[model samples]
Every structure is written in C-alpha cells, then in structure tokens.
Target: MTTLKKDSLLKGTLILALAALVARMLGMFQKIPLDYILDAEGQYAFLAANNIYLLLLVIATAGFPSAISKMVSERMETGRYEEAKRIYKASLVFGAVSGLLLSSLLYFLAPMYATDVVKKESITLAVQAIAPALILFPIIAMMRGYFQGRQMMSAGGISQIVEQFARVIIGLGLGILFLSLGYSDTVSAAAVTFGSVFGSIAAFAVMVYYARKLKKQDARLAVHSSAEARAALQPNLPYATNSSMKLKFRAIYSEILKMSIPALITSMTINLVYMFDTSFFISITEQVYTDERATEAFAALGTKAQSLAGIPPILAIALGSSIIPIVAAAFARKDQAEVNKQTSMVLKIVCLTGVPVALFLTASAYSVTGMLFASPTGYETVAMLCAGTILQITMMTSNSILYGMGKQKQTMVNTIIGLIGKIVFSTLCGYYFGVAGFIIGSTICFLIVTLLNLRLIKRDVTLHVMGKKWIPYLGAVVVSAAACWGAEYVMLNITEGIAEKLSYLLTVLVSGSILCAIYGILLLKLNIITAQDVEALPGKLRGPMRKVMRVLRAGQSG
Candidate 1:
C-alpha cells in the first residue's frame, strides 16, 4: 500500500461537512414530502416511532464509532497496523451482536413500546419497519469508524451520500405508492420507514466494497513488508503470537468499552430529550387543546419545526465528528499545543457559523418556516429552538474535544445533568405552555450542558475561544439580523395581498442573502476574521475569503 499522508484536519472536516449538508438536505426533503402525504396524525405517529428508533440506535452504536476512530488512530500513530486491525475486528463482533439484539428487541416490542411508552398505537408499524435498519446501521457505523481511524474519510463520505440518496428515492417513492394504493396512513408511513432499512443496506454495501479494496492493498503491503523484514534478518523483532494476540484482543476490548460507554451515554442524551418530548408533548398539549389540535401541535413542533431547526447544526456535528480523531491523535502524541490549537479552531468556527445562523433563523423564523414548510404554524417554537441550536452546536464541539482528551466520563456526567434539566423543564413547561414550553426547556437543557462542558474544557486545555475578539463577530450578526428583520418587515408589508407564499419566499431569500453578505463584509471590515484566519480556511474557501478581505482592504484604502 502507498504510505498515507496525514490528512489535513480542516479538509477532512470540510469533506464530511459537505456530505452531512447533503444528507441533511435529503432528510429535510424526505420529511417535507412525508409530511404532505401523511396528515398531522400520520406525521405524529412517524415521528414518535422515529424517536424510539433513534434512542435505541444511539444506545447501540453512537459512541463506538468515535471510540473506535480514536483508538484506531492512536494505534496507527505508533505504527501498530496489526493492532488497529484487531481492534476493528473486535468492534465488528461487538457491533453485530449488540445491533442484532437491540434490533430484535425493538422489533419484538414495537407494539408495547408504541402503545405503553408513546401512547400511540398507530406508531407500532413504523417502529417495526425501522427496526431492521438499526441492525445494519450499527455495522455500517463500525465500518465508517474504521475508515475514519485510518484517516481515509472518502469511504464514509461516499457511503453517507449513497445512503441518503437511496433513502430519499426509495422512501418517497414507496410512501407515494402506498398512499396511491389506498393504504391506511399507518401502513403508508410504515412504507416510508422501510426506507431506512434499504438505505442502511446501501450504505453497508458501499462500506464493504471499500473495506475489501483496502484489505487487498493491506495484504500487498504486508507481503512486501515481510519480504523486506526477512531480507534484513529481523527474526528477533517483536511479532504477534497467538497467545499475545489473545491478550491484545482482551486489552483492546476492555479499552473500547471503557472509552465507548460514557460516550454512548453522552450521545444518548439528545435522543432521550427527544423521547421525552414524544412521550409527553402530545398528552400535555391535549390538556389545552383537542386531540386533533394536540396532534397538529406535536407535528408542528416535534416534526416540522424540529427538522427545519436542525439543518444549521449539521456544521457543528460535522466539525465535532472530524475533531475526535484529529484531536485524539494529537493528544496521543502529548502535543498539548496541537490539541489546544485544533480545539480552539473548532470552537471558533462553530461560533462563527452558529451565532449568525441562530440569529438569522430567529429573526426570519416566520418567513423561513413559511418558505420551507409551507406554513409558519410553529414559527415561535422554531425561533426558540434556534437558540438551543447555537448552544447545542457549541456543546457538541466541546463534548468532542473532551472525548478526544479522554474526558468522556465528565461529559457523561454533564449530559446526565442536562438530561435531568430537559425532563423537568420539558414536562413542566409542556404542561403549562404547550409546544413553546418544550422549546424553552430544550434551550435551557442545551445551555446548561454547553456551559458545563465549556467550564470543563477551559480547565482541561488553554482554550481561548469566544474571547474579546468574538465581540465583533457577535456585533456583525446582531447588526445584520436587525437589518434583515427590517427588510423582511418592509417586504411583507409591501407584498401583503398579491401572493402571500411568493412574498414570504422572496422576503426570506432576498433578505437572507443580502444580510449574510452584509454580515460577511462586516466580519471582514471589523477585522473579526483576519488574513491569517482566511488563510486557515480550506483551499476552496480561502479564495472567497481572500476576495472578501480584498474588498475590505479596498474599502479602507479608498
């Protein structure tokens, strides 16, 4: 095999982020059609079932991928390819057993879970339909984790695109077909849920193909290495024996679990919060509204608004995912400087992207919701949720940094505290304030978690993120958001009766574009992002950044 160069951490992150963006778009599109096809009742059922599926899925596999990636990278850094391969093999076994067992449990208990837990009998079929995907997804996650450990991100990226593509085509196609065939809404929704199974299978095939190709290359490299070693009379060198291999496997397994369990609990926090909403929101809303109205409210807040609000945070997720292995490798080398540098850069980028997106979403909630989801029913909820998005993005990046530094236990503790806050706030707020209350609860939960994680990260590393320098960035976002809000207000008033939907779309598109441009210009002018920052961007982004810098310079010179 050709010797692999160390991947540029930023480039790897950008690749994953681009793929994540596409996947998130596909996910949003899937929801739009599904929401249209199924009424609010069906959408509620689907989302309720999905929450259960996500919780189980996270419990089964979320942490292993990051743990495997970190472990594999650490081993590879020391030239222990064989050990890394052993770690991968052991993880596959663990993934298969756990995935199948959990999948079986979900499949068998779908009725009870839907009825007793979610209090929605109509969701049972959807839960069952998604169960098989859980099995395949965990295995696929392990494969992706292995590749990520090797710093070969293309396999994971390609598989993600393929998976999302297959999901959109198959899911929407099947849902429409089933609806056309006059199936019950539950059945039609279940058909859409099957798309997860098909998508996971597609993703699995892609990963397997890549794995086989990699194995061939590794085999050739191994043969060449053996020949060279023999020729060099390296007979006394340390080589893996069967007994030693068993000991190594034991060590790897223990370490894997040690690293993965806390991470698993930390990841499960988000799903747990969602599960809380699903179980409580509808019932709580029914106290104030009719059952039908409650279902609509649930669909608006939990399904439509939640999905739309989640789009911007994909950047943070991608950044966090990429940070794990990169920071892990740096930490393994005891390079505190590199670790701090990567952590700070990741935090800065998250803030720079997150703050503006949060402010824009909050400011343009009505128009954006109208344009994206065909109505602004839950615009207030979405606006509130955007605050949580910023907090959650920052918290996720912080958690990744902690995980990289082997601080999963502390992160898990913080997540548990946040989870408690979520349960208490969501329940209390939902009972009194309905959907808006759930949104507020979520914001509080994320804020608590983020602040706690930030404190821990500060103690762990010399991170200087969001310092005095970030004030200008915040100022730019605030000014731009205010300008966009004014522009939107004018546009809405001017286009009131001619075409409401068209007006909303135009207001959002035009205002969003102009304001974002203004924000970028202000960031440049305020020196919030200097030339060094522009140069630090990936090559593709650096050119545009440089052009912005040039414009700023010209404005100053003139």
Candidate 2:
C-alpha cells in the first residue's frame, strides 16, 4: 500500500475523498448528458425521481453507516474485538430486514409521491424503476460501514466509486439508445433511473468480495486476541450461540437504534432541506407564477445548480466519514489531545481548501452553469448557493465530529434547530425573490447549525481553529477572489464575442486556471498551507501541491 494510503485517519479520509470526488463527478457528468437527452419536463421528471430516491437512500445508507462505524470503533478500541464483529453482524441483519421493507414501501408509494407531492404523475415510472436498488444497498451500506470501522477504507471507497461508475455508464448508454429509438423522454428518464439497479448490483458484488476477506481477517484477529480481550466479550456470547443470542440481539438492536436514528436524522439534514426546496419551492413559486414557469424554475435551481453545488462538499463529506470512527476510537481511549488535534484540523483544512473553491465557484457560477448545462438559467441562484455552502459544509464537518465524540444528542438537536430555521427562512425568502430566495434562507439555517456546532465543539474539545492562522487563510481567500474578479473583468470584453455556452466554457477554463494558480501561489507564499500539510495529501495530490509550493518558494528566493 502507498504510504499515504495507510490506515491513518488523514490517509483514509484522502482515499475516501478522492473516491467520492470521482463518483460525484461521474454523477454530475451523467446529469449533463441526461439534460441534453431530456427536455425541460423530462429533466424535471428525472430529477424528481432521483431526489425521492436519494432521500430514501439517505434513510438506507446514511445513519447506519456512521453509527456502525462509531460503535464498532468504540468496541474495538476497548479491545472487545469480538463484540465489534457482533455489532457488525447485528447491523447486517437489521439492514437486510430494513432494506427489504423500505424497498417495498418505496415501490408501492412511488406513484403517490411522484403525482401528489412532485405534482408530476409521469415521474412514477422513473421512481419505481430504481426502487429495487434499495433492497440490496442497505446491506451493502452495512458492509461498507463495517469495513470503514475497521479502517479498511479502500474496500468501501472502491465499491462506492464503482457503483457510481456503473450508474453513469449504464444510464448514459441506455438513455442514448432509447433516444435513438425515438422513445419518449419519459422512457429515457426511466432508463436513466434503472441504472441505480445496476449500480447497486455492481456495488453489492464488490462488497461481498471485501466482506469475505474482512471476515477471514476478523477470524485471525479473534485467534490472536488476548485472554483478557476474550473474557471481556465472554459475558455477551456471540449471537451464533443459541443460549443468549436472543437477549444479546435485543440489546444490539436497541444500541443500533440508539445511535443510528439520531445519526440518520443528522445525516438527513442537508437532503431534508433540499427536499423542502423541491416541494416547498414549487408550492411557493406556483402561487407567484404559472405552473409551467414554476416547474421550469425548479428544474434550473433544483437540478442543474444543485448538481454543481454538490461538488464542493466532497472533502467535508470525506472528513465526516473518516473522522467519526477515528474520533470515536480516541474518545473510547479518552485521548483528549488527539480529539483536539483532529477537531482543529477539520476546520483548518476546510478553511484552506473549501474557502477558495467556494469563492471561485461563486465568481464563475455563470461560466460553470453555462459550461455544464449549455444554459445559464439559474446562474445567480447557484452563485449565491455556492457561496452559502461555506456555512453548510463547515456545519457538516462539525456535526460529524460531534457525532464521533458520542454527542449524538447534541448533533440531533443542532440539526433540528437548523431544519426549523431552514423552513422558516426558505419560506420567507421564497416570498421575496422567488425560487432563488430559498437557497438564501437555507444558507441562514446552515449558519445556525454552524454556530451551534462551534459552541458545542468549543465546550467539548477546547478548540480554537481560527486564532493563529486566520489572517493568512483570510488573505489567501481575499486575494484569490479579487484575482477572479480581475479575470472576470478582462474575460467579459473578450468572451462576449463568442457563442453563449462556448464563451462561458472558455471563461471557466481561463478564469479557473488563473484563479487556481493565484490561490496555490498565495497559499504557499503566505504560509496558509505548509509542507507538512502537503505531505499529508494523497500521492497524486501531494506531488502536484509540493511542486506548486516549491516553485513559489524558489521564486521568492530568486
């Protein structure tokens, strides 16, 4: 294994982060082609089905994965390796049963949600076509989470990327074929939706292979476990034993619910807010404009803009995934210093990487939207939305850190507050500016969560991430944002003569290159990112980042 791909938390986070980036980028590219194949109404139907499917997916994969990882990490840290395995087994059984029940519920209830809530009965086929994926994915999620708990991230990371890879390839291929056959856009949407089934199958196969290997590894660990370790778990015999299996399982499920439910609620926070955007924004906009206009607006803001916005959170999501188990293990060992170190690093990395990207995306929102969708329908909304994610992504990182520290209750409370804030803000904002206002309101809600998390984190870990390096970090972001505007000013005069999407595409390429170059140089010259930080990056990124820093340092010396 590569040194940077070792089982350290930072390494694991990098692996998962890169994998998620690939998967999400594939999903994004998948949308670009689907947007071309499907017209306005077709895009709406396609997105509606996927939204419902994704929210339900949050139910399936979100909470249990984090919870399983945390619980298993805690158990293993305490040297109850066997009980850690039991936690995995118990969660598996729960996943199988829950997955089946939820899958059927989704299949049967598709028509109601598509017609009644989304107000588009045509999306029913699209929704129902992907329902079967839920049946197996819950189990797959369980295994992936279990692997993560063991710090074997490559298995889960590769499986998730492969899953999305399959989804994109199948969805695109089938979608193109159906369109060539002169089928309805409705049929194309359904074909795209069916890709989830293939994705789940591919993912399940990968998970099975990894699960088998991990099981063999687990057996070896058990054999080598100390006597004291064995005795600690002896009291709660394996569920395979008939004697106390039933009682032990009762406790196991109870534990699962205890952690998973809150984690589910917390994990669902972002998706739930987006769900509000879909139904709530549509409902609000319909009152203000014609049904067709509202639907068109929804398509722009919800589908195209949101897809682009999803890219920035990749690091936060990866950190959240990798952080919980590592923090939980440290907490289990009562390592306060490690917790503080990790908690501080989370915000530092977010500030270093996330802030600059958010600014660039905001500045070039039109270019990005135009480049991707071949239209800039919701450019303004997306611009502000991308900026607002600075708050949202930070909140997500803190929430995960709190959850890892076994503060599920606090995180749940924070989410609940954010949800309420989001609903109120979106409604009020929608009243003022139409669909664009909703994102503003949700951004406010995210601010609420971020503040709450900061308070709690300060109380718990005694962290002050901003004290020492705040100036350089702020300088890098400010200078880079200014560079973007400067480039924007110049590109405006030049690119106006080019075609619409092509002009914007060129602008994105040129401006993005300039902005990143300035940002990277400033990050090194100002010491916002150090050599150690670059060293911590995965092998692929490490080399490039080091070269940037080296060139900058050498330039300064010369």
Candidate 3:
C-alpha cells in the first residue's frame, strides 16, 4: 500500500512536470511563426489586447480553482460527496456569472481602454476580438478545478495542452490569412485575438465531457451497491434538503466567494503590474515616437520582447502549482520534516532548471532573436528581455516557496517591493534606454524581491536553507557560463551551414550537460547526494542515475 501510494505521487508529479514542459515549449514555439506574420507592430497590438484579457481572466478565476480544489478535497476526505458536488456546481455558476460581467465590461469598454488608457486606437478592435475569450475561459477553469480537486490531473493536462495548442494554431492560421488578404496589421491582430475564444470553447467542451463521465461513473457505483452497502457508499447529496435549490446555490456560492476573494485580490495585484506596464509603457513610447505608425511598430517590439522573456514564468507556474498541493498535504499531516524536504527539493529543482535555461538564453540570445524576428529592433529588444530571465526565475521561485510556507503577508510585502521597484526603474530606464530599460528594470526587481524573500524565509523557517544551497548553485552557474562561452567559441570556429547550427546546438548542450554532470559528481563525491539522496529520486530517474555511478567507477578504474 505504501509503495502504491508512493508510485501514484511520483506519477502525478511526473505528469505535471511533463505537461509543464510541453506547455512551455508550445508557448515559446508559438512565437516563431507569429514573429514572421505580424512583425513587432502587430505583435504589440496583440500583446496589448491579450494582456488585458489575461488580467481579466485572472480576476475572474484566480484563487477559485486552487481554493475550490482544496475545499473539495477536504469534503471528500470527510465522505461528504454530495457537498462536494454542490460546491463544484456552485463554483461553476459563480464563474459563469462573473465571466459574463467581466467580459461584457471589457468588450464594451474596449475603445475607452485602448484609446484613453493604452493610447493605441489599433488596440480597440483587438480588445473587442478577445473579449469573448474572457467569458469562456472561466468555465474551463471551473471544470479544471473540479477534476483537479478530485486528484485527477490528466484531464487538466489534456485541456491545458489542447487549449494552448488550439490558440496557437488558430491564431497563427488566421493571422496569416488576414495578412495575406491585405488586411491592415491591426485587423490581422484582432483576428488573432479572436482565436483564443475558439480555443477556450474547445477546452470547455472537453472538460464538460470529463465532468459528465466522472458523474456517471459515480452514479453507477452507487446503483450497484446493495441497500446497506449503498447507504455506506453513498455521498451526502443535498438533493433531499428542505431548502430550495436556489438558496442552497446561494450559500455555496457565498462560501466559494469567501475563499476566492483573497485569491482574486492577490492575482489581480500581480497581473495588474503587467497591465500597468503595458498601458503606460506603450502610451509613453507612442508619445516619444510621435508618428502613429512608428509608435505602433515600437510598442509591438516591446510586447514581443516581453513575451519571449516570459518563458520562465510558464515553467515556474508548473513547478509552483504542483508544490503547493504537496506542501499543503504535508502541512495537513503536520509533518515538518516532509515539508522541509519537499521545500528544499523544489528550490533545488528550480535552480537546476532555471540556471541552465537562463544561461543558454543569455548566451544564444542574438542567434535566437535573429531566427525569430525580421527586424533588428525586435532582435535587440528580445535579447535584452532574455537577460532578465536569470533574475526572474530566481525571484519567482523564491516567492512561490514563501507562499508554500504560508507566509502570505510577507509574500505580499515582497511582491509590493518588487512591483514598486519595477515601476520606478522602468520609468527611469525607459526614458533613457527605451526598450532595454524595461528588461533591466525587470531584472532589478527580480533580484531585489528574491533577496528580500530569502531573508524572510531564513528568519521564519528556522533554518538557513537559502544560504547553504545558493552558494553552490551560483558557483555552478558561473562555471556553466565559462563552459558555454568556451563551447560557443569552438562551434563558431569549427562548424559550417546546417552543420553550424546543429553543431552549435550540440556543443552548447554538451557544455551545459558536462557542467551539470560534474556538479552532481562533486556533490555525490563530497557527500551531497548520499545513499538517502539516491533513494529519494523518483524510480525512473533513479535507474538512469545508476549509470552515472557506473561511468564514475570506470573513470576511477582507468
């Protein structure tokens, strides 16, 4: 039974990790063709429009899904199955009503939002196009919360993949078609905005199917039980209650709202930072540029650059989301050791993932940006943006960990500092350096917030966890930088044509791979990853790591 439980958890974590990888890859790859179709100007309009919609989506669904998942899990644990259903149903209704209100407001106010706030008349149409997605997206969230609450993650995985893929595919196709037909870039941008609505529709359909199937299975199980067994097995359905369904719905909705409001506030604050940046930066850039067309084009450059820099957040969300449930469960069991262990592992994994990604991005920024965009401005801006990832990943991970440890107020305080730092630095830098300033400001914000949180975590958690692990991580990163530089030199000197790109990729891969391998071997040889460490790795990863041991043995023998 213990083994079975362990295996299930490993599988779940693996699934989450794999899904996250796919989502991140999809998000990054989506930009390749988009850069070609829209140019940076069109991208700016699209980004501007999409950022607003994204913020709205967060407001509508931010904390509800996670909170609802936790609530349902508790109810199910106590065998209150009917209560779980009522809660879920109530949540869905609330999502629908809220989505409608938000979507309508945004859609109708698009012109004001675009012209008055963003200072881009082009964005007005794009806002209208994306408005429908605001309505559909929350329903998808509700169903996802329901399934996720039941500890069924596969459906969530499938829906997220499909939703993202559909958006990319449809958006790209329509953007190309509109552009080819000689529509203005602004119109083409609006078409791309509308594609998300279609994607959400498809995703919502799938979630509904899954929810219904789950319900039917539960019904069948209830029916098959004998009278006495049925009584034992039956969930507490509120159907027999004397109260009207409407009253019951209202009560459930109230409960969900109480849990979700704080989440909404938190999410709104976080998302609002980006919205504020987009609106003000784009408006100010437009004012600085003078020419309407030039302003549009320049704004798009900043938008695209921001998008490229955002890849780290995608991975962070995946890791952070999975971490929360595990931490929460550990907390429920009052297992301090498990909580600390998981927290440490998450931090290590974040560094392990973030350091290499950021280094590679920084090292290959020019080639990567060149490959993705036609304009030199786009390339330069994205390269600048790429530089921010190192700080962003570290800060983001630390903040997530703070939240996991139940340090909400501290998290808010740290976030406010970061946001304030971003605004001040961004304004100053943007005035002087234009697009580069934004990314630099972002990096500064990340560094400051991360350090602040690190201090808090050390004080609160009763351990000097950050100081112990961070030194080695930084050392490894510095070594990686040297290795990547050396590898780049070799690739440029020795490789040609397809051979050139392939060789550069391989050399870079090898350089980072070797650095990581050496780091691990040193950690093991120095007693970092001891026998206990080997035992702690997931079963699949453990077997392959044994080969590392064998290779080390052969090296010693030789």
Per-model lDDT: 0.78, 0.78, 0.66
Could you give me the TM-score of model 2 versus the true structure? 0.84
Please state the error at residue 439 of candidate 2 in Å: 0.5
TM-score to true structure, per model: 0.86, 0.84, 0.82
lDDT of 3 by residue, 1-558 (tens): 000011245565566567556755765566556666775567768877777765755543346676777777787667666677778878788778877987899889989877788776777888889888878777777776776667776776677677778877898788889999999888998888787888788778778777777677566555564555434443322122233243388777776666666455544543565676667766555544554554544554445566567665666767776786677677678887777787777776666566666666566554445445553345566656666776776676666677667776676677778878888897787666665666677777778878897888766444423445456656666766666656655665665456444655555556556656655665544433445556667799888877776676567579
- Give the Å error, residue 292, model 2: 1.4
The sequence of per-residue lDDT tens digits that candidate 2 reaches over residues 188-271 is 888888888898899899999877765664464357766565444332223232223333777987877787888788878878
RMSD of each: 4.0, 5.0, 4.7
- For model 1, the stretches where C-alpha displacement exceeds 4 angstroms are 1-19, 55-62, 70-90, 149-151, 214-253, 325-342, 469-475, 524-527, 539-558
- Please say which candidate is ahead in lDDT: 1 or 2: 1
lDDT ranking of the models:
1, 2, 3
Per-candidate total of colliding backbone pairs? 0, 0, 1
Relative to the unseen true structure, what is the Cα RMSD of model 3? 4.7
- Which regions of candidate 3 fall more than 4 Å away from where they truly are? 1-21, 56-62, 79-82, 227-251, 262-273, 286-304, 313-315, 375-380, 460-473, 489-535, 543-558
**Two-way TM-score contest, 1 vs 2, winner:** 1
The whole-model C-alpha lDDT of candidate 2 against the native structure comes to: 0.78
Candidate 3: the clashing residue pairs are 44-300
